[model samples]
Target: MHINPYGEDPVRLALDLINDPPGSASELGRRCAAAGLVIDVPPGAADLAETNRFLAAWLGVVDAPDETARAERLNALLAQAAAYPRLTNHAADGWHLHYRDPDRPLAAALRALISVGTALHLSGRGMHRLGRCAAAGCERPFADLSRTGRQRYCSPACANRDAVRRHRNRTAADHG
Candidate 1:
């Protein structure tokens, strides 16, 4: 089945990239392809640099102090990235909406996808959906795609570690 590529996938991709960034443009391209993105052009050094810059800006949005600040930062990113939507069947998989101009570099296309997807995700879910993990000493970023919208950790390991720490602290307090 054909899913909209501009929604959760891109946001998730952004989160993955942020959490463990690609080492090079080739790695970035490989990761994006693995994430189901169709890369029509080969990624290069410029794409890597641009993608790093874009992710830094996106992290600014994720770490924004409030909804208003987040919205402002996101707006700036959208302005810099997205264009009018167009219909395309680039891979012949099926016709889909593209939020960027055709034949752009991998980095440019990724910027648009991430920006638009993040906007959709935040607005459709909640402005507070994107954030740092609440596990103490592990502040990695995550996109809260959980059904309950109460995710507080970046991964199961982090959550379990934090929970164990809390239990130990409570036990120590009781003994003391």
Candidate 2:
């Protein structure tokens, strides 16, 4: 089985959606496809609202204080979503397991995919894998798939900015 929904991509998709929300159902479908998720059905008005609510709730899991706390939050979410595992090959590429039924609504599918993907990621990787960017002033959350597991920022640009700021602060302290 291809685990973690292929590493950081699933969480990256979640971050992208959270950072810049889609304005319409079509936009959501487009964004999900762009993020490598195979969307079999397009979303509608209700799907959009449902997706928005789901994402907001999912953010709470990301913002949880600790691993155990995060797991509890995620488990609650999964229980609420209440999907079962099944196999699908929407794109005709190959068979893969889905935690949702084929005919489920778009929002429900997203909830299942995002929640299950998140659980797989955290359990397979590490609890510290998901967190808010450590860069000053950037509150965006990210999933770290780095080999060393020391990533604290969303991107290299943020990391570089934080590093420069730290260096300048240390130099100023020494001079003063």
Candidate 3:
């Protein structure tokens, strides 16, 4: 069965691309395929550029001042990639919903996929679920898909580093 491709997977893929973008379209295609976004059209130079542009705009949603601003930014993305939802077995896997027209290149597909997926993620989870890491030295963006929705760091390593730093500072102050 074909798993739904428009939720957490797309958000994670967006974060991966935003954090460390592919240097070439081939790499982008490879990464997307790995992330369960196997589109019909292969990624090319144009797709690479378009994906980079989309991610730049998406980052604004991550860094918005508040939920109102965040919703506004995400709405713009949804508007740009707007397509009537339709069902198809275009890939011959099974019938499923798509937010964009079929046979579009990787960039066009990603635009719709990421935007809608993010909307579902934030609306389904919480607007506060997307943000930069709370760790002092790292401001990297992340989508908090955790069950508790209290994610504040980009990764476990960052969480550990920040915790250690906090503990050391507290100990030094207490001893002083």
Candidate 4:
């Protein structure tokens, strides 16, 4: 069965790339493929640099403090990647929805998928679901997919760190 590649996978891939950027186009292609993106192009060095530049811009949207700012930033991305939605079997697993034309290079396809998927994810889930980790000293971006939608940290480690901090404060207050 064809899974929805446009949702969690793309967001996760964006986070992974943002956290640990690829060193080369080949590496970017490899990592993206590992993250469920099907790359058709033999990526060149330029593609890697270009994708990173694009991601930096996208990160601006992720970092936007308000929903209005986020939407404006995302609208710019969507306009840049401009493609009509269509159903296709690009993966050949089965027919599914695509927001891009077929056979585009890895960089272009990523721009479309990541941008649009992020927009959908944020709007469908909640505007507050995407943000930098709330844990002190951790600036990683994350798309919160938690059932309760209250997630603010990038990982369990960060969550635990914040929890410990709060617990320590509470204990100190009690002692005082």
Quality of model 1 by C-alpha lDDT? 0.91
Residue-level lDDT for 112 in candidate 4: 93
Candidate 1 lDDT, tens digit per residue, 94-155? 99888998889999999999999999888888899899988988889998888788998989
Clash totals for all candidate models:
0, 0, 0, 0
lDDT of 4: 0.86
TM-score of each: 0.95, 0.91, 0.94, 0.91
Per-residue lDDT of candidate 2, residues 76-114 (tens digit): 988877767877787788998878877777898888878
How accurate locally is residue 16 in candidate 4, as Cα lDDT from 0 to 100? 89
* Model 3 regions lying over 4 Å from their true place: 1-5
What C-alpha lDDT, on a 0 to 100 scale, does residue 145 get in candidate 1? 80
RMSD after CA superposition, every candidate: 2.3, 2.0, 2.6, 2.6
The CA lDDT of each predicted structure is 0.91, 0.84, 0.91, 0.86
| lDDT, model 3, position 21 | 88
Q: What root-mean-square deviation over C-alphas does model 1 reach?
A: 2.3
**Native-referenced Cα lDDT, model 2:** 0.84
RMSD of 2: 2.0
Candidate 4: the clashing residue pairs are none
Give the clash total for candidate 1: 0
The CA lDDT at 95 in model 2 is: 90
